[model samples]
Target: MQMYNPEVLGVSLRHIQNRQERRVCEVMTAELADDEDFCGCTLCIEDVYACAMSRLRAHYLHRVSIVLKRPPPNDLEIREEVCAAIEVVRLRPNHASVT
Candidate 1:
């Protein structure tokens, strides 16, 4: 039996990351920037980020991969997820209201 070693294959395991993360962050940033009412506290922001990431399908990839054959999620879809996440966090924020 042979054990799989990414290092031997010239690929680092740490290089693996969800491709959707970048898109999600971009969309979320835009959405948040436009909404002045949304909480800007650390906890609220973190919660919204986590919630949005959870709802979207993860497209993981190795940094070494040259091409991504599959198309990424639609822009509208990502916006919808980020919007919903913001609403969820706003309605039931974990931390108390901050002055």
Candidate 2:
């Protein structure tokens, strides 16, 4: 009897997310890093990402047969999502004030 190993096959399920979504989140996080009121710790940053992503419509790219995927458009919606994410982090920060 041989044991089946999925890792050896080099195949796994993954969430195909919009690259722009990450880009926007990263940019926002960096922009807010200097704000004294904003906590830029790892957990809070992750919270921001989660909150923002939840509010925006996600674009997924998967499947090997799929052709080239277009870049996500930068629009007002992206700005709104980043703003909302910032607000969420501000209101519910997981770290203590450095001051």
On lDDT, the leading prediction is 1
Model 1 pairs in collision? none
Task: Report the CA-based lDDT of candidate 2 relative to the real structure.
Answer: 0.70
Candidate 1 Cα misplacement greater than 4 A, ranges: 1-11, 63-71
**Can you write out model 2's per-residue Cα lDDT over 1-99, one digit (the tens) per residue?**
585443436765445546567667666766686777777788887888878777776666665536656545466777778778888788868777566
Error of 1 at 48 (Å): 0.7
Best by TM-score: 1
Model 1 quality (TM-score): 0.76
Q: What's the distance in Å from true for residue 18, model 1?
A: 0.1
Tens-place lDDT per residue, model 1, 7-28, is: 6476567567777788888988
**Count of clashes, each model:** 0, 0
Per-candidate alpha-carbon RMSD to the true structure: 6.3, 6.8
* Candidate 2 colliding pairs: none
